[model samples]
Target: MIAIAIKNLSYHYPDRTPALLDINLQVKRGLKTAILGMNGSGKTTLLYHLNGVIPVESGEVQVFGTPVVKERITEVRRMVGLLFDNPDNQLFSTTLRNDIAFGPRNLRLEPALVHRKVEEAMQLLSIEDLADRPPYCLSLGQKKRAAIAGLISMEPQVLVFDEPFSGLDPALGRQFRELLDELVSGGCTLVYSTHDVDLAYAWADEVVLMHSGRVLKSGPVDLLCDEKTMMRANLPVPLLGRLFQGWNEKPRTLEEALNLMGSTGLAKGKRLQA
Candidate 1:
């Protein structure tokens, strides 16, 4: 089912240079979608519109079938959780554990429920080790995971992540990807924006390429993240992407790549091929 919908959406800054124009999009439950764009491409601006942080100058946005208006804005925002790139912006509690529990506590869930939720979220994000640490003391990666844990505690149906990988180390990027996969399995819808074509291609079921505040293309990752499409989007498919370009096989996940290579027998038996 469609958890979020945006139709004919457009936005403009106070400077009024146009942030988005005629944007139509839908996010289904339990699906992972990547919104890819370079700087000044309106990725974050559009994300703001999704959760109703920025009112649309023209268009309609509905979250979980809740039409966004002043009266219903809080409802919409509650239904859609947002994890900004910087965890500092989202994590407000004195400690990681408190930050994780803060959301459910605000919702008035039972104390037991709140504790369970926080523990589950922290464990799921694999940051149980950092649960008691101060939010400001965490490394960039741990802070990001804590931010995600905070969002998870809220248990929103749809999540909008803005540049979750920015400033993250390579290992952290992969760890975040695993968390995203787990979130999708748990039936949380995701729409994350990033400038990295490679990670977007690896993790996203659908890639939406935006440029000049317009959607240049939207399609399967393999189709839109190809060489030609990358060139059109002014991005590059990673070295692995270059290796797997075309040839009838689609490698969506890391495991799929290894399986494909082994299944296709990329290396022949030359006596030393054990």
Candidate 2:
């Protein structure tokens, strides 16, 4: 299923500066898609259009075959949950539980059902321990998780994130990745924008490279291996891509790379004995 489709999409700022120019794209359902671009490349602008946060000046956007028009804006938002680059923008309630519960409550669900949804979201994020703490006092990583829980509570079919790992340490980043994996395993379509080429290369099932408010290229993660495309997008070649350039086999993570090296060494030792 086509989860999202953008056609001839263009947007501009209040001063008439173009933010997105004639963009066309389609995202498949249940795929982990990474939008790769540098700062000021219109990544966030495109994301805003996904959830109707920004009005579409010209062109059309469809979520699950429903056109994103004024009449359907509310429905679009309900289908696509967005997480801002900064967690503070989304975490406004005092307590963590309140913050996560805010969405379902607004939907006017029954009190008991809202409570159940909030608890389930917190557990899914493994943030049950922080339920009683104030969102304002939580660490950056914790705040991000809480912000995600807030969206999860909404039960949106698709989740969109902007620069999700901006301030996370390696350990916390791994945790976030695991959370994302769980979401996808549960049939959620995931879309996120990032400038980190390495992470995009290693993590995404599909990649879209944007430059100067236009999509330069979009295809499978192997697109990152094209040095010319990476250079054109002003992105550095991912380390693993550069290391295993000509080899048909590529390792997507550190553990896989280590295993590949060990296997290669063992094969070489056997060859020497023969």
Candidate 3:
């Protein structure tokens, strides 16, 4: 089933600056898709249409076959949860617990049900201990987890994230990826935008390369293996592809690269002595 369909999409800023132009794309349900581009490439503008965050000015955006129009905007938002780049923008409650509970409470669920939902989301994001603290008092990573917990409480079928990992150290980033994996495992479709080629190559099921308000290409992760296309997009080839450029087998992930190295005896005598 198709989770998202965007056709003939175009957008312009109020000042007459073009943001997106003639975009046509489709994402399958339960797949992880990465929008790849440099800054100002219209990736974020296109994502905002998924949940009607930005009104469709010139084209159509469908979420799971439902049109994202003002008449059904609430339904679209219910089906698609968007995570802003800044957790502060998503969180506006006094305490972390309140922030996490906001979504369910707004849905008018029974109080007990809302509590259960909040509890489950907190546990899922491992943010239970930070519940009573104020959002402003928590670290950036903690605030991110709290914001995500709130979204998880909504149980949206599709999660739209704009630069979800913009400011995290390596450990926190891995934790976030693990959380995303858990969501995908539970049948949620994931669509996120990122400028990091390595992250997109290693994590996404597919890649949509955008440039100058247009889609350069959209296909399997292997599409990133083409150095020429990466260059044309003005983005670097994924680090993995660069590291193994001439090899017949190009591995996209670290494990795959290690396996390739083992198979080719590249690591035979390179082990560091203890």
Candidate 4:
């Protein structure tokens, strides 16, 4: 199933500055897809159109085969849950529990179901201990998880994140990757935008590179390994990609990379201890 489809999509702000130009994309169901671009390259603008957060100005966007029009906007939003780059923009409830519960409750779910969803989302994100805390008082990383919990609580089929790991430390970033793995295992389609070429290279099944409000390229993760494409997109080749170039094999995680390096004696050196 195609989770999202876009054709000739273009958008501009009220001031007439173009944000997206002739963008075309199709995201498949249950894949971890990443949109890679430099800042102001239309990554967020394209994401906003996915969930109907911003109206489609000159073309069409369809979520699960339904056109994103006024009559179907509600349905589109229900199917696509978007997480902003800033957690503060999405979180507004007094308590963590309330914030996570907001989405399910707004869906008019049964009270018991809403409660269950809130609990489940918190547990999934390991934020149960933060249930009583106010979002305003939480750290940047905590608030990011809380915002994600709120979206997952709604049980949307597709989750869209704009710079989801911007404020996380290395440890939290690893945990976030684990959370995404669990989400994909549970059949959620994950679409995210990132300026981190390393993360995009390692995590995405498919990648889309945008430049100047247009898509420069879109294909499998191998697209990132293309020197010309990465240079054209102004993205550097990821460390692993550079290291493994022409090797016909790539490790997907740090542990895998370390293990591979160890087995191949790539980590050994004349000055290093055996």
Best by lDDT: 2
In model 3, pairs of residues that clash are none
Return the TM-score for each candidate structure: 0.88, 0.93, 0.94, 0.94
Q: How much RMSD separates candidate 3 from the native structure?
A: 1.8
lDDT against the true structure, each candidate: 0.82, 0.91, 0.90, 0.90
Model 3 over residues 71-182: C-alpha lDDT tens digits?
9998999999999878998888899999989999988999999999999999977888999999999888788888888998999999999888887768878987998898
- lDDT for each residue of candidate 1 in 1-274, tens digit (9 for 90 to 100): 9887889988888997888989988877788889987788889988888777788688898887888767787788778888886778888778899999988988889999999999998888789998888899988888988998888889888889999888777886777778778778988888999877767777788778888898877876775546676677777776567777765886766788877877777634332576
Candidate 4 yields a Cα-based lDDT of 0.90
Clashing pairs in 4: none
Off by over 4 Å in 2: 266-274
Candidate 2 similarity to native, TM-score? 0.93
Cα-based lDDT at residue 36, candidate 4: 93
Task: Encode model 2's per-residue lDDT on 197-247: one tens digit a residue.
Answer: 889888999999999999999999999989898899999989998887787
User: lDDT per residue, candidate 4, 1-274, as tens digits?
Assistant: 8889999999999999898999989998899999998889999999988888898889999988999888898898899999999999999989999999998988999999999999988998788999999999999989999999999898889999999999988887888789888888888999999988888878899999999899999999889889998899899988888888878678866778888878888776522865
Query: Candidate 1: worst 10 consecutive residues by lDDT?
Result: 265-274
lDDT (Cα) of model 3: 0.90
